[model samples]
Target: MMVAVDSTEKSCLSADGEDFFYFGYGSNLLRERLQIMNPSAVLVSVGCLKGYKLAFGLFKGQENHWGGGVATIFPSPEDDVWGIIWHLKAADRQSLDEQESVKHGIYSPIEVKVEQEDAGEVMCLTYQMNCFNYSLTSPLYKEVMCTGAKQNGLPAEYIKKLNAIRTNNYNEITPFTMQVRDILQHLQINTSE
Candidate 1:
């Protein structure tokens, strides 16, 4: 249950003109990476998407790729999905989509309403996990999930919650992510449940 924190000016406007709100449930939560790519991007808020379960169902055949688990969007009235909301330009958003491989049957763009610190209600682009591209047996699964969970500066307690799950492994968790986590921890940014 990590909460999105804003570190920019008071006004919630996209300077690049094509600025849009992106719901980052996983990898896109990493601020260091995002800031490097899009300096104008700002974290807005966070909330749970109910009804979907996190699982690996998209890449059942690709063994060479990381065995990463994706957040599957399903009809769940009781389950709550946790994530962050980021505002970025259209071009930077494209970079995010490319990094996440959103078109690989792993993710699908959907419309969502996000809460902002000052503006309140706002429409944004949220992606649901593409169950079609999930891989259940990949070795880098857990680490990859953790990487995303921790990327938003989630607290250690929440990160521990994510680490508690060992259904899969993420041996391919990049060194860059590890470094980002370390730096975020040092900065004391909390993205926890």
Candidate 2:
């Protein structure tokens, strides 16, 4: 899906014009998770999307690879969702879209205005779920988001809210979760350096 850009929104393209900004509110907020498929992704800034709230739901009532619901954003008049702004090569767009399951009709790309402290309002590409049947996310999935939020220095109140989210209590270690765990471990180690 093509997102229309408004003239007033700040451009966030890289110098070569071969990169674009993406606002990641869900699993993509985790650097390791995003880097797995889109290696060109680089942290740009932390921002908040006003007038939207974070949500989790099953896609077509089916659990995702994470073994439970996945994260998405929905319109909320008084809320704001805090997340990371990533600068990525234009070549990674297809892989990023696939990671969000856009081709499966699970998500649809949308253009949003993110309020950044340093950059002001910038137009970015983000995704929202097509289905909103509320569901619980897996414990590991929630952990990934919380870790990313903390690691990236999102607001304390927002991190507290993320920590308060209830999980599906999926304790069994799936192969995917195991890989994610390893990535998180490595990320933790690297961040400490």
Candidate 3:
């Protein structure tokens, strides 16, 4: 789907480009993966979205599969989630949609209110987890929450809450799981234990 860019951000671009704002929370939060996924994407800023928590959804099975947590859209009066925003050209969004599995309904876009670093506010299209395929069995789930905790300055209580999540005892490596492992290595956390 095409997202219309606000008139305010248009001047920042070089031409009459159809820009699409995407809010990324999971592995997409890691710049390396984003670079691999969309090399042309411009980093707009770091931002936050209220009323969601990251969790693994859109599952294929317990093994030889993976999924990532996305902001689950819901009504909340006092919750906010942090993430990165990217301004992508509409032409490149088709590949992103495919990478994100949009048509299969594994992901659906939503217009979210986001706080920009310098621009203040922007309406962006972001994806939410399918929820139908969520399971928290892997230790990587905790690793991801810990990564978010370290990167986003999330509260320790939040990390504790994340650690408390119930999963189905899964033992397969998803890309998301690999990401957490990478994050640990990046942080110089020993995995030898």
Candidate 4:
């Protein structure tokens, strides 16, 4: 079931004027990917959103910039989605929304309660696809998610689940795919140093 965010929850999410918490389960799970646009984001903790399952889909019959499906969450009583909690400056909110294509109506911002190991339950801002039309993600896109999952130390079982997701296996070179590859390469190099 979808939990509504009450006024109290909203206050708690942004108690301070400067920052707020964001739950990232998709490509945004990667620090480098997020920082490309929202540089002020900082890793706060890892958390799990119960009663939801990870899904990949095309938004309104349109493929994502990566030329494949993108990640979103759906309510599922028996499932849980693990992801990173990022604390970001309030000023970065617009950039984050733009990154998620909020203005385009591809994703809608929602509030979710995430269970954190040390902090307990906290309300955070997350996005869900407006329309869920199942589609396979590209191999490179899935690889980025898997790499982020491992980087954040998510459970082995969850990582395995992420890896098991079938890909479109798109190998044809395109500008969008090339851009993603370049970003991944640059981020990997920076992390190593």
Candidate 5:
């Protein structure tokens, strides 16, 4: 799952030669979620992605999970998507890409400008769904988004929008999905979300 990076961004690597910035507009907005796979992930800032809107239309191909869509960004001149900026070791980039399903061609990384307080703007890699067919969202997935949004302290209005989103009550048929539900329950999560 090699991602062909243009020579331009290759110049932005950190001095240690293993750090890169990422703009998280989706579930990865949750530092904890990203940390699950990449422990070195650090939240550098929070900001809005201008000229883009959050969309839950990217279908997940993973089996025995939510039969709904995940988050991605779409062009919208009138909107801004609130998200977090993360810095991780460059060594974990491929693992992060795999987590986002880059090998399956589900998402592709691209450089985008994010506006953060004090920092003004920073160029970082973000994932965008290449799938065109829009779909519904799963309730559990929505819970993750809402929890993540609140954890990052996004705008009140944006958080409300995320909470208000409708989701499909995707039944747990696969053992993995069921176990996920069990874990959420054990943790006293808001499954109704």
Candidate 6:
């Protein structure tokens, strides 16, 4: 049901100096987080990936609190994954690849057709869980996803779905959780979301 919004620069340079796009549905929904990692990244639009459902799972062998499940897409004809489209300089590919842990094989980038609110359909790369995780999300991690969704103005129904995701119940703040706090602070996003 997404319709078009006003357009912005829609260019993303890949590793081979070719422009491409990235669809972010997880923590990357926080523009600040992606900006911090890839300065050239720009918001293309809020969009949805059809035929897929969002799920969280752990990356096999990753240790500690981060070992908790991260966001991923699973094929489901009845589902549409809401997310943001990002355009980046082709040269920024390596940095994004590293930041995304693509080097570690924890996630794999796959091409998908994301329907922008106002822009129709466009093919963009989105990461999917390639390794197994604990299948649980931490409280702080859930906060990150919910806050990002609210900050970006994603649909209220979808935001509620994000909020309803059950967590592992650990709420103690840790150095790792601080990363979410930092992004929230940087973007001035309300945790109340």
Estimate, for each residue in 67-99, the C-alpha lDDT of model 4 and write its tens digit. Answer: 688899999999999998887878888888899
Which of the predicted structures, 1 or 6, would earn the higher TM-score when compared with the native? 6
Clashes of each: 17, 0, 1, 0, 1, 12
Which candidate should be chosen as best, given TM-score against the real structure?
A: 2
lDDT of 1 by residue, 23-92 (tens): 6655455555456556666776654554545444554444434444544455566654566677676667
Among all windows of 10 consecutive residues in model 2, the one with the lowest summed lDDT is 1-10
- Candidate 2: tens digits of C-alpha lDDT, residues 1-193: 1233232655543333456789999888788889899999888778899999899998889866798888999999999999998878888888888898888999988888898756577788899999668899998889999988887789999999999999887867878888999998887788789
Candidate 1 ranges with C-alpha deviation above 4 Å: 1-17, 35-39, 63-65, 103-105, 115-121, 131-161, 170-193
Q: CA lDDT of each candidate? A: 0.55, 0.84, 0.58, 0.82, 0.73, 0.76
TM-score of 5: 0.80
Deviating ranges (above 4 Å) for candidate 2 = 1-17, 189-193
Output the worst ten-in-a-row residue range by lDDT, candidate 3: 7-16
TM for candidate 1 is 0.61
Candidate 6 lDDT by residue in tens digits, 1-193: 2222333444333367775688899888877777777888777788988899898887774654543677888899999989888877677788888777888787787777788886687778777878665477777677778877887788999999999998886666777677767777755645444
lDDT of 5 by residue, 1-193 (tens): 1122222325333334567778887768666667767778778777788999887775444432566888889889999998888877877887888887778888887778878855577777888987545667887777777777887788899999888888877865676556545545644455355
Give the lDDT ranking, best first. Answer: 2, 4, 6, 5, 3, 1
Worst 10 residues of 4 by lDDT: 1-10
As a TM-score, model 3 comes out at 0.63
Each model's TM-score, in the order given?
Answer: 0.61, 0.89, 0.63, 0.87, 0.80, 0.84
Best of the two (5, 6) by lDDT: 6
Q: lDDT for model 3, on a 0 to 1 scale?
A: 0.58
**C-alpha lDDT of residue 101 in model 5:** 79
Where is model 1 poorest over a 10-residue stretch in terms of lDDT?
6-15
* lDDT of model 5 at position 11: 36
